[model samples]
Target: MEPRFLLMADVAEQLNVSASQVYHMVRSGELPAIKIGGRGQWRIERSKLEEYIERKYAETAEWVRTNPLVEKDDPDLS
Candidate 1:
């Protein structure tokens, strides 16, 4: 295997967003990350990224359950 973890730019491309956005996600704790350098070089595992996405959707569902207004106002459901 080349490497299990991916660099910031690679992860951003994989998610189809800017690297700065990815960094923001990491900072916000939306995505799992690891720092490698003194300058705060961050990397994320591919598997962890997938798991993060799943967890995000799951959390959204849970939030809708507890916050019924969101589900009620979501026009896309009907």
Candidate 2:
């Protein structure tokens, strides 16, 4: 069967972050995940990962809107 969930390591690889950082995000509730199996393995749902990426994009857009870019060398500005 096809896979529906991703391991913490997999998520870390996709996010280009360390597994420890992913663990921290999960612990801080910044990312949604679940612990399963006897070893309490962490699993991130595919859809939830996608949602997190989309949310981050939206948040970055909002931040850029609030903080204008000031170019000191721009002839139009100065």
Candidate 3:
């Protein structure tokens, strides 16, 4: 069974991004996380990470809808 919570490094690996990027997301409140232990380690819930991914998918779809692609060689380009 997968762990309920994941380390910052684990989240980074899953997202294919640098650890610092994940840390920044947490710090910026874009991704919810919790700091635990006396040393203050960050842990992100697996469900929350999944939620973030889904949210990004929705946001990307909206962006694509609003920003239609511009094809090259279009008369407008000239």
Winning candidate number (TM-score): 3
- Candidate 1 regions with alpha-carbon error over 4 angstroms: 57-78
Model 1 pairs in collision: none
Candidate 1 local lDDT, residue 39: 93
3: Cα error in model 2, Å: 1.6
* Arranged by TM-score, best first: 3, 2, 1
TM-scores of the candidates are 0.65, 0.86, 0.91
State the displacement of the C-alpha of residue 60, model 3, in Å, after optimal TM-score superposition: 0.4
Which prediction has more favorable TM-score, 1 or 3? 3
Residue 3, model 3, lDDT: 98
Candidate no. 1 TM-score: 0.65
lDDT of each prediction vs. the true structure? 0.88, 0.93, 0.97
Per-residue error for 49 in candidate 1, Å, reads 0.6
Candidate maximizing lDDT:
3
Model 3: lDDT equals: 0.97
Alpha-carbon RMSD to native, per candidate: 3.6, 3.8, 3.4
